[model samples]
Target: MTRQKWTTEEQEVWLEERKPAFLIANQKRCAAKSFYPDLVKEFRDKWPVPPVTQAEIDDAGSVELATRVKRDKYDKRTSSWYPNNTRTLSAHGGANEILKIKSQPQPRKLQAWQAYHALTYESKWKPHVNKAWTTYKEEWLAEHPKEKPEKTRLEVMVEFMKGKFNEENDDMKKRCEEYRNPEMQAVLNPAKAKPQAAINEAFQSAINLLPRTLATIGESLVKQTGWNITILAGGPMPDTDGTILTYLSHSGKTKEGDSFDKFLGKKDYDDHVLCPFEKFLHASFSMDGEDDKEKEMDDEEWKKQNSESEENENQTENVDQTKNGNKKSVGGLSEYEKSKAKNIAQLKLVMENLNENYPFPEDLVPKPALKKPAAKKEKKEIQQPVERRASMRNKGGDKDRYVM
Candidate 1:
């Protein structure tokens, strides 16, 4: 099949997708020590390569300067010019400024030369250039026959169709087996080596290939399972969460988010002090003893294992963290404290690496204020001349006393 010419396409589209490939064949024909201005001008006029803009050059210069002047210890250290930068982003640059194009010098955009070339280089010139180039090549080959190699009929040079996988091609399996490498065999399972086209066809076999919306799925589910499921949603309970809750109430309807209520429903919880809030009606995936089990593990060299406090409050949540599948203690720090510390460390590293000169925020670590202990209440000496007992006052303004 003949390749479709880009020049034959619509004027607007071809103009937009303007890519010029010049043949520098004439350069070889020039005299040994002589400069060819006429020859250079001929090709230059036909396939004009425009010079880059001053703005582009300036950007490149700035990038080069920034590269040479990297974030060093002198830039970071507390000096008259450079302040002590602990953590800041502005020292490096904004997200846009840090981009590949902004940080590193980029090649000029197509529009840089398109305006000048599009007006000058017409679509008709493509044919003329192709013809002239072809003629010059033939003439050169004729003049120097030795430059062109003689053709040979090598019997092994048979063309084979290298296209999409055909089931009928029995030779493909043999060829695959012959060229099978250990690396490929280790990576791909032969049992599950069905073609992607087959899988695609199998997946799209359904009558209705259009996406099934939430409502459609819900309807289908209702039909499948004859359960009259009232999708109680909205209010404090997030509707989008898709939480499935099943309950039988002894009283009135349950409130939003929580079903537990004295009047509505009573929850049977093992009476304990400082117990983690366990929702009875919830995903039972974590109800197993695995999550509840906490071992005294000190994996990190710097961090100390939390010695079990006499107070049962330590047994509550936020005791251990499962970060990236590694169950490690948060050094007895709360989530907020852990996040703040992590942020500070990250920012500090960035500051040192990027040579940021922004001043660190003051008073991040709050001062621990001393709390005064409360004084005990002193017992008042209540003495009567004769026998007396503690007197009781009633709401009716009547006083009753027992004789001692």
Candidate 2:
């Protein structure tokens, strides 16, 4: 029997009729190959490639072209291919088509980090990204309402910055209120309220006692100094009768003549007395104006002694130069003079600390005055009132008015 050649229209009709069966067969083959790749490989190895003639090659190429055309037509009609519009497998293709389907390009899902970075940095995409994220969160919550896992990196960053934003908002609100009120302006504006030097002096004074306290009492006690000693010692309790309190009471007298134990239990003596005494000792021994005055006097005495020593040295050198025909030499300050200078420097440091710790009021600060001239002026001013009264009495002929 001879094979019959079909016209173009007839071939199209035939292919359309056979398309469903071809697709069913292709799907079954793909499933089998996917499930049993080893079996497929073994079968291919058993039936290796056969030699092809020129006529066979030509026929195969023509058939492949036709299959491709049919696949394209079917894809265009159904729009069923992937987004790239690329076919992965075909009924007319080989086993490679099945593998292609397995390795088909999937839609690229956004990673958490990538999505977060884009949302944070890309202004254009932020709204859309945030909307999508909000939707995802709503859906996720709906699915797993009760479950709460650790926050993601983006979530943590947002939460941390959120607090900063709130603080900034509060500060802005305060500034706005300050702008509306004239009285609050001076206090609210840090630059205008306190001068930098005053602020620095206050800080220096506050920290001046720190070094001495640390040297005397260690860091632990200094850190815990804020706590009440009664709380540190233990909760409220009655003091023992035969303790150090009794001995101290014997050494000292109380206003009420109460026993030391009773006094200790009644008031917070540790806070009122001991702490203040310690601070006083630290300040007194550390450095003060009295120490500075003493150092200045010592320095003057040292200068006088140094000058005398230099003069004596010069005289001795002159004598030696006359006796041995050697050159005369000048001498430097004595060791005692050098020691005085060092002591003065130490005293000066103390004066600085005193000034910082105990700042004087502007009214109390003493101003330089010419004592003799001021005294004379005050005397003349006082006599003027008396002289005026005397002249008035003499003019009025009232001698008794200005009594002796």
User: Which candidate leads the pack in lDDT?
Assistant: 2
- lDDT over C-alpha atoms for residue 273 of model 1: 6
Question: TM-score, each model?
Answer: 0.15, 0.13
Supply the global lDDT for candidate 1: 0.28
Cα lDDT tens digits for candidate 1, 1-404: 84553222353242233211111222443321232333334434553433445564476576444433332222221111111122247545653342221243553343312322222224323354455555655776788866852321121111001111223245644444432443443243454356766654554332111111212333333343322212211111112121221211111112232312322232221111001111222222122332322122244521222122213223323212212122222111111122334544554565354333323224222335324333232112212411132221111211111000
Off by over 4 Å in 1: 1-104, 109-122, 148-362, 365-404
Give each model's clash number.
0, 0
RMSD of 2: 42.4
Q: Per the 3 Å backbone cut-off, how many clashing residue pairs does candidate 2 have?
A: 0
> In terms of TM-score, how similar is model 1 to the real structure?
0.15
Q: Write the per-residue lDDT of candidate 2 for residues 1-404, one digit (tens) a residue.
A: 73543224543453455445445555676623442333334323544333444565476587555555544444333222121123555445753232121343653543333333322334444555466557666776788898753455467445533433354555554455444454554454444456756765655443332222222232222222221111111110012110111001111113353322335552444433333322332333333323221111243443453345435443432121122211111111121222434555555665565466545545335446425447677687656654554532212111110000
